[model samples]
Target: NAGVTQTPKFRILKIGQSMTLQCTQDMNHNYMYWYRQDPGMGLKLIYYSVGAGITDKGEVPNGYNVSRSTTEDFPLRLELAAPSQTSVYFCASDSTGFYNSPLHFGNGTRLTVT
Candidate 1:
């Protein structure tokens, strides 16, 4: 089974546009995270959740976040999009909360805001 999958591998958005980047995992993980990577930069956290119905903010403010409501899906929503939001976004999940638990990652969704 695919550990994790992200939809719309590439997308383009206009200023003020809004979109949801879909992330799903078949591993039934309780921990999930969203991250964005800019050119020549490291991954910047966007948001994360320890389990369904719980979510926490990260460094970047993509927009308001929501609880997964299900362990298999975590969608990142971007509102009032701007050029600065352009980047490759990644979604990851860990079966256990342990620091050393293996992380499963999606291929990544590339977004461009014009």
Candidate 2:
């Protein structure tokens, strides 16, 4: 099964353009996350959902939004994109109630806001 898949592996957006990074996991994990990595800065959680119809903000929530309609899908939306938002976005998921379960990650979507 495709553990986690993200669409549009790369994209470039204008300062005011917006886009949604699509993520889906086939493992039926109960927990999913959206994270971003910047130069010299480690991964920062953008948003996460413990389950369907329930979501929460992470370390950096501004300029971004997320929705978890099903355990298999989690999409991250970027509104009015900016240069500051340029980074590699990743989607990950892990099964709940399991300590040793591997965290599955998408290949990552490289977004550049020019």
Candidate 3:
């Protein structure tokens, strides 16, 4: 089974265009996270969820939104895509929210907005 999966491996959008970056996992994880990494920078948390129906904003939640309606899916929405939003986005999950739990990361979705 796929531990985690993300769609649209690459994308390009106009300044105001919008899109959804889809993420799903088959590992029955209780915690999931969305992160974005800009060039020469570390990953910044965008949003996260502790379980189905429970989500919270993360370090950099502006310009984005997330929902966790099920244990298998957590999608990130770009309301109005911007040049600053151009970054590599990743979705990760762990069975538990413990510090020692190994995270399963999906292949990143590279987005570029002009």
Best by lDDT: 3
Give the per-residue lDDT of model 2 (tens digit) for 1-114: 778999989999999998999999998889999999998898999999999999999999999999999989999999899999999999999898377777789999999999
- Where model 3 places Cα greater than 4 Å from the true spot, the runs are none
* lDDT tens per residue, model 3, 9-106: 99999998889999999989999999999877899999999999999999999999999989999999998999999999999998988989988899
TM-score of each: 0.94, 0.95, 0.97
Q: Please list the residue runs of candidate 2 whose C-alpha ends up more than 4 Å from where it truly belongs after superposition.
A: 97-100
Ranking by lDDT: 3, 2, 1
In model 2, what are the clashing residue pairs, if there are any? none
lDDT of 1 by residue, 1-114 (tens): 989999989999999999999999999999999999997889998899999989999898556364598999999988688888889999999999797998788999999999
In model 2, where is the ten-residue run with the lowest total lDDT?
96-105
Candidate 1 lDDT (Cα, 0 to 1): 0.90
Q: Which candidate wins on TM-score?
A: 3
**lDDT of each model, Cα atoms only?**
0.90, 0.93, 0.95
Candidate 3: RMSD to truth: 0.7
Better of 1 and 3 by lDDT: 3
Residue 7 of model 3, lDDT score? 97
Cα distance off (Å), candidate 2, residue 114: 0.6
